[model samples]
Target: VSSIIVPITNVMNDQYCYQTSKKIRQVFDYKRRNGQYIGSNPPFGYVKDAKDRHHLVIDPDAAEIVRLIFSLLLKGTSKRGISFYLNEHGIPSPSVYKLEKGMTVSNKPDGNTLWSGRMIHTILTNPMYTGDLVQGRFRVKSYKVHQIETVPEEEWVRVADTHEAIIDKATFEKVQELLLRDTRTSPQGRTVHLFSGFLKCADCGRAVTRCSGKNNVYYACATYKSRSRNACTMHSISHARLEAAVLYAIRQQVHLAVSYSEVIAQINSAPIKKNQSFRLDDTIHAKERELAKVTRYKQSLYQDWKDGEITQQEYRDMKATYDRQINEVSDVLARLTAERAELANGVDKEHPALVAFKKYQNIDALSRELLIELVDHIKVYENGNISVKFKFADQLRRIAEYIDVNTAESPAWAV
Candidate 1:
């Protein structure tokens, strides 16, 4: 009797424990999906709102540090460099800062705490800084096991626009792009070169490696210079000449962007041409009528066959013809309707390319920030020539096309 009672009590205690854990997880998941802040502490840049513990509000001092981290990364500073900069400036690491704020944290320091490259990397990569609530990054393996495991990114709960953002979306996206690239830093340098990961060899399609000559810094094809010479030729170009050419190209683009902006403004101000939309509407109406007539003809074929006015084979052939015509007319109507909607929408003056280029209109020198913002990559030819593929290339082309179509004649500059 005693043995049976003890076993029954043990089983009941385990069942209660499992049920409690399951209920807790369900509650947390519900909060996370609803964009509530479930974490004990907000991320480094923000603090829990006084009125609502589930909401986050920016903490000015910490938010400034967060912005500095992003700004330094954009300026080509390496993660290690940023960490060193913060430590040298006597700024506290996230854990240290939290301790100073009298907040309880699990990872308390045993001795002097210092910032690290990994910490900087984490801060830079966190999308929470961009005003989104992302939770469930890690979860317990099971109620019984109690082992933590990383959750796949797709499985993580994300809710956008839950709080004020420390970093804007575009800048955050740009940082993510840069992180994926192989932007190596120069030896004994704290920051990457202006074209660290941007230069590519036009011949072999390999990265262009930077070299130091007796007096000048130059870049050569990585395949030719480091790997077998038989693989590719030296597409070497001096840094000064390349920089000058790139600066000139950027200025040309800025000039073009200003011109495009003015043309777009003029186009926007002028009343939209009703004739274009009217023509599209008329074509759509005609197609709709054609579809209706074909559908009616298809419906009449069955009656004609029943009345013996047409043979079964003749009715089948006629029905197939009408079906084809109906499909064709329906497709035409869809296309015409889309065109009419586009005509009504008109050209956007604040197109990203126009706005981005206009921001750097007075550019005189090239910086890593500017290059990352405007240029996608620079292809170096064996003939000492470089081709820069700028960002928003497609948008620029669309803007030019829009101007050409709307204006009486193509502007001489545009041509």
Candidate 2:
């Protein structure tokens, strides 16, 4: 009776195993048909079958559409804007094209009929747009689940010029640059403003959003706009007013910057200690010595590990401690080097900030280009007191301090 029961259990096991194997094959077949196997892989045209993997060909029309999409995105059109542009013009999306031909497609979001930001961003970042075919960017964990992990970019299988590029290299690079620039902001915490992310609201710690009425541009508190009167009041300011204040402040700073150069020149021409050059060198050398000492200490911890004087865990912890000390020393050395270089280069005479500011020295008014170049941010406070911050203000302030310390007499040009 025991042997009969064992045979029955063995029969049950065999049936389960067969069913599991069959299901596994079905899943693999589904994946192969739907392109999920190469979903995260680089676009290398359509793959017809397993045997014909290398025989894939480029779809010229799809390549042309990709180029057009890249152009629209680079022109400051948002992803939604691009999708609308495409759909309104009766261009079929990738999903739509597949569906029309009765091809099975997966991974589409429910209830979405067309293109989306994720799709556009994917296309924008796709190296295929630049005529490079990428493959093996992700992988499934197991046969039971569809979860996938992304492969590192460096490890991705890349084939260059596998298809005609939709966008040129230079244009693609320009789009990338534009994308890298900080642009969008969520102010009011609900609606996004083009300029909302660009400006900061001083009172409520929210971004100021742009609003237009009767041909006038005004910025208001984003929190107040979304949450209501309970949150915050609308710290409203007109665009024209903001623009005027910013331009005026920039011009004033430029004037100050130009004057600073003259003051530095005056101070440099004055009689000072001729031996000060050696002092600067001594300061730099001392920093370098400190850096070397920390590096040597860090190396000794590794030596302890090699000599079997420390456990693996203890060695790791001690090495980390020494590494942190080394980093701190390195940071100090870098600062000292920069300061020494500044002193040697007659920093007051040839600072990049000073040079850039001097270019507009004779200009009467500020231009858009000038504003972007010099200004970091302009925060409008609750009390209507605007604090204008210039780029590299710390360096400028340092120069001012140096002038105060070194100059025997105050120059007329010193602001």
Candidate 3:
């Protein structure tokens, strides 16, 4: 009916088609603004709740599989290894599982129900696993055309705590780090060597390459590998020696972060705007509570109208009143929330940056996840000496010089 009407209205050169399209988009935007999941399908680990299809609930079986994939990846298992493990154990692939649940899925020729590295990779990297409802990732180019275009990431509609998380945010973030971090895979697509692109020759400033087998693993300068020792020395470092040193340095960095308060103390003679910040925080919470209450009341009014307890005109007027109040409260809430975030946006002992390192003190085994989190690079020298530069290494020096020396701190410092 929509297709027939649109083309027919266009023949008459009327505004009807355009107006109809605009109204449809308005409804979609309103639903999106209200945090509704407007997609036809929930993500792999989730299922649409029976009570409300727009709401998502954890599918325990699929969610368990998702968790297992993340766990294996964090433990330094390659995507290929994960795929093989799942397939070898006769575990159904995501597509197969989706088919079993009566959702649309496809299988390839020969009835082989094997999981591939690509499939495992997609699951590991999906942000939806972290309890965030991420939609609007793709959209039609226009109302007239059906071609789908990838929406800019910034434009994605995301809502947090929409459903139970299959994996923690930390784990999800770590997986993303691993994906984007400069790392190489072996013949079997496993990262046999932990420090791949991160290792460079000290003298030549070239990346070090991993050469040799299980009996002896070594990272030699890339220049030497390409042009032999004339261009650069081996800068040879055994995996064991490099791993042990780098691991120790990372733990020290975490320990250093613990005492960062001393540096902060020099900057702030008095405690942070304790009273003002505290009050602002309290006010933000109160406003949020008010917003929730108003939203619930507005929803109740809709039911009241449906039950004929209120006239349609009265319902409309009440809803408009509630919506106006919601908008005013939301504006205040956004401003205060932004101010609070600005005040609290640095690495403390409790910050995820430092907390990640603090969680692993002993460092019995080094994984790529921890390596990328802590170290920026490892430079190997010809004389078998190596140095590990950590991520945010510059931040420590800046923290020590907390007062910008030339400029006084902003009054918002106590924000």
Candidate 4:
């Protein structure tokens, strides 16, 4: 009798465990869908709301630091340089700041409050700073197994506008773009020198870095620096010479853009008329129509299956195919529509990037904004042959093609 009672009791306990697990999972899923901040602590730029633990509000001091980091980045300061500035000013890193506020962190950095490039980079890249709530990045394997595993990025739960933003979306995007470029810092002045990441090895197509020279600074092939010259050429360009070359190239383009009617004509014509501009609109419309047709077919699939026209498995398979095609067409249609809208709106006078060269017409100096916007890249050959590829080169060529076909009034540019 005792053995029978014990077995029954074990069965009852297992049933209770199963039900409890299901209920807990349901609660977690509901919270995730509602865009709550589930983490124990808010991100660096924010503090969790006292009454509503799931909501976040800007931490004024941390928010200011975030803005300064972005501002310095736009001004061409590299991540290391920014980190140095923060450390030198005795500003606390996020972990340190939390600790000072009497909050306990489980995995704080081993080091002190000294800032590092990695810390700055993490904040710069985080979408949370843009007011997007991204959760479920890691999860327990199951109820029985408590091991944590990283969820793939595609599977992470994301909801936008969950809180006030510390950084504007445009600035965040621009900072991301800048981070991808060749920006590096000098240990000398805790500053990022001009043309830090701009130069590249013309031969191997690798990035060039600055290194010690006899009595001056010189740019050398990064590959050579790592290995030896046997791997790549010096591909050397001095700081003074490289700066001058870049400046001269920019000044030349600015002169042409401002003084040359041809440049103005190209800038105007490039957006107004693309040979494929009409094609983009036509393709989008076609895809949108396809999506509608697929949707209509999907609606009929259930009825067809109900009337015994197709097997259950076949009905499901065909329905899935139609749904997938519909999604694909919708995505393509959206992208093409955005492209068409952007080109159409480029003619607006208030658009800052539209014919940006015009703003620098009376230019006396070059800014990071101008450098990034106008120059795609500069290639330095071993023989000191510097090539500056203007961002608008392809557009200028297309404009020339347009003018050639439409009328003979267009002036041809001489190399």
Please report, in order, the local distance difference test score of every candidate based on alpha carbons: 0.87, 0.65, 0.75, 0.76
lDDT for position 33 in model 4: 78
Q: Mark the regions of model 4 whose C-alpha exceeds 4 Å error after superposition.
A: 1-26, 50-52, 76-80, 95-117, 144-148, 181-183, 223-232, 253-346, 355-376, 389-415
Ten-residue segment with the worst summed lDDT in candidate 2?
A: 188-197
Q: List, residue by residue over 229-279, the lDDT tens digit for candidate 3.
A: 798888898888988888777777767765655444543554553323455
Superior candidate under lDDT, 2 versus 3: 3
The most accurate candidate by lDDT is: 1
Best candidate according to TM-score: 1
Residue 39 lDDT, candidate 3, scale 0-100:
78
lDDT by residue (tens digit), candidate 4, 34-91: 9988788777879889889999999998899999988888887778888988888889
Candidate 2: what lDDT?
0.65
Q: Could you arrange the candidates by lDDT from highest to lowest?
A: 1, 4, 3, 2
Error of 3 at 371 (Å): 2.0
Higher-TM-score candidate of 1 and 3: 1
lDDT of 3: 0.75
Error of 4 at 114 (Å): 4.4
Clashing pairs in 1: none
| Cα RMSD, each candidate | 8.0, 10.8, 16.2, 8.9
* Per-prediction TM-score: 0.78, 0.48, 0.64, 0.65
lDDT by residue for model 1 (1-415), tens: 9999999999999999999999999999999999999998788999999999999999999999999999999999988889989999999998899889887677898885999989999999999999999999999998889799999999999999999999999999999999887778878657987898899999899999889989999999999998999999999999999999999999999889888888878888777632243334567788888888889889988999999999999998898888888888888787667655655566677788888988987778889999989999999999999999999996676566566667655346544
Error of 4 at 123 (Å): 1.8
Point out the worst 10-residue segment of candidate 4 by lDDT: 406-415
